[model samples]
Target: MHDSRAVPFVCPIDHGVLEAHGDWLVCVQCAQRYPVVGGKPVLLNEANSVFRIADYTGGNAYGGASAYGTAGDGSRGLKRLYHRIVYTLSESGAGPAAPFSASDAVAAVQAADPDAQILIIGAGETSYAGNITYTDVAFGKNVRCIADAHDLPFADGSFDLVVACAVLEHVADPARCVAEMWRVLKSDGRAYAETPFLQPVHMREYDFTRFTFLGHRRLFRFFDQIEAGISSGPGMSIAFVLRTTLANSTEHRALGAVLHLAGLVLSYPLRLLDHIFTRSNGAYDSASAHYFFGQKRETAIPDRDILQFYRGA
Candidate 1:
């Protein structure tokens, strides 16, 4: 439900309003033109432009694309296949919790500020219509654009809501990204955001970070309201690592599918087992993927204790 044309966007350079100019977007104030490619606006600043996801999965996805078959180190292909299996597992309600992220944060923000202008940072390769972003089924015209988190094109204080989902982990400088989010929000506006509290190796072009609950709280010290939600725990972590690692092995994929099916069949019973045996490892290691949000308030100020306690960037 993001409407790009509803709220006027400002130029990051001169704080000027922006207008769409053919293939490029122009800032009315500074006259800077940012190209729009494949419907995504590239708004990176000079300080942080080139971003890449780390090779967490060993290039399995890309390597396995050849219809003829794979050569070289097929590790990449395996990784890709592993993720495919993971998604399948997610669809079937198998493996650990589904990879929930800033998408939920976006919904939370929308709930708080229905008519506020919104921007999605690191809006990478995702479609707002059919993808995770607000679907036509959810919001009629809610979100406007999915722009890079580090380089937001809009002028300062132009957007009412900003969502930086699991994107901060990939950025070279998370602090700078947070500062930019703060800069773009109105004095009294709030941003709904979340980062992984517990996650494994992920390559979003580059996965450089992870956050603890306290760490997440600390990052949004500039906001008036900061609340942290729990995320994945030891048992779930083990399930993810086991399933992914097994799925990555050529010999184990077929086995992994069988395992996944077995997991699903046993899920209800295991869950019952978890309930009866609360002290068991599976029961003992439960955790929810944590989410935290902060609202910008004009008069309300940050507290020294919370700032000092959770200050992690």
Candidate 2:
């Protein structure tokens, strides 16, 4: 269980301090609940039916986790280089900032101004915390981490910047999620969001959809300035295709365990190839993810639209 005093964030659905309950976290507010097995929150009930939670819990992540084949030492190497090469390639495609190191982008903003108030949406355990690792030691204490994403608990225009990573894909309505982010952001604030484009079925506890680069651009149209691009090289696509093919085999259920083990071994060599072939900038034909940064333009408030207002005014 997390030490509440240390984290202090409440659940978005229930607004209660998340308390550990039988391998899950139960909220006292709405009583809406989720699991925390393996130290990762199981945010969606739907995941229980579609995924093998037991397999995930047993350290058989190669079979049960997202990107089923990228768990072993060998596969991990390949996956890392795959992301590195792809991200490097994406930097050359478009935008002010380079595509490499979201950690750097995040750190750059935090370091530029000491008083910059920031918001982290879908404040999951890993990605958010991981970003903080690269943050300058000077600004670490000033940041706030909120656990809720669906309905941000803060007042509107409360922050100078907002960051969301790999989050919209898990929400029921990506459009609504984008709207909420826009709502909380100060008129002058900028927001950064990143998500996968073509990847495996892992992170499916609440996984809803993936975006094409163009689709991401459409989603962020509200912003005055938006830059959308992809991440990871072609090797990731190769890995996805191979595993997906195996997963659909007629005898999959029977041979899944063996195949998963085999995948771990294969992932290493594939990762090496990724480094060789994907080291330079090229068109994102094989980009596995997408990211965008947008600056809010001062505009009329959206929620107070004509539909809800009196026509006589």
Candidate 3:
């Protein structure tokens, strides 16, 4: 169970301590005013981020309606059905097993300190046990607060473990986001990240970047790596490419959806090949996604040392 009182909120601009005053949190140092929406603070740096605090407080975030449809509109079921279809198509083949268990990492941190404060960036619908704080750019049922990765609204060294799975690719400035992750973590605190390498864009405008295995490792050079390797292998890459290409071939939404499904059905079997390909060193070059788990260090790993860590053929 996450306790909201464990971590103190801070102003995104000056990292000043915030005190609640009516429906707003006023910074003690900078006196910046941030709104509290539905009991959750909308602590965003408006100048630096694309999102404005008014977007949430004024209810214009999703244009006064949910993007995925609402229960009252009767489109919730359709939205769910659409997601199911997409999942069915994308999960056709046997994909590579994740290199590390996120649950295991949580357990490890908890073992050392049962009350360890954990932060999950881009948490989406995922939930974890213990003192966890869930944050995302968009508000959701699971999200405790709305925050931007580029400028996190927490005091320095506030968290014991920071998880950013499937998030780096969406940020405009991944390096800056990683730096913020590093900033929020306590000294020697652990950090985990999973990023796509060969997968095609899915978030449309939100998707901006990808990283190879070594590149992903280099991104967190400020931390000493605990483990780093392919989370999804070349097989997933092939499946996604085929699906995207076929889907983009037709302008009609219905036809494109059908083509996408067909592509998955035709290419799913190839995904099993990941089991074989992942065993080879060359798989690093063509992996669909990679994960890195590291502990924060005062000094960054040298670039020359990072180059020597490459394993691709």
Full candidate order by TM-score, most accurate first: 3, 1, 2
TM-score of each: 0.61, 0.56, 0.91
Per-residue lDDT tens digits for candidate 2, residues 1-313, read 2212222334544345666688766666767665554445533323222333343455542221123222322545755665444434322332223354455445656676545566666433324332231111011122242123455434466565677777777666777667767876678777788877777665446578876655665566566544545455456556555655564554666466445434534553554455544554442545566677878865633533422321111
Query: lDDT, candidate 2, residue 121?
Result: 61
Task: List CA RMSD, all candidates.
Answer: 8.5, 10.9, 3.0
lDDT values, one for every candidate: 0.51, 0.51, 0.84
Compared with the true structure, model 2 gives a TM-score of: 0.56
For candidate 1, the lDDT comes to 0.51
| TM-score preference between candidates 1 and 3, better one | 3
Candidate 3 Cα deviation (angstroms), residue 30: 2.0
List where candidate 1 sits over 4 angstroms from the true fold: 1-5, 19-22, 28-31, 38-40, 51-85, 91-113, 123-146, 247-288, 297-304, 307-313
Question: Which digits, one per residue and each the tens of the lDDT, describe model 3 over residues 1-313?
Answer: 5444667778989999899999999999989999899888999998888788888988776321123323323445865676566675665448767768567678888898888999989876668878898888777666777888988999999999999988899888999999999999999799999899999987678788999888898999999988888888998899889989998998999889788878877778768889898999998999999888899999989999998778888
Candidate of highest TM-score: 3
The candidate maximizing lDDT is 3
Note the residue pairs that clash in candidate 3: none
TM-score of 1: 0.61
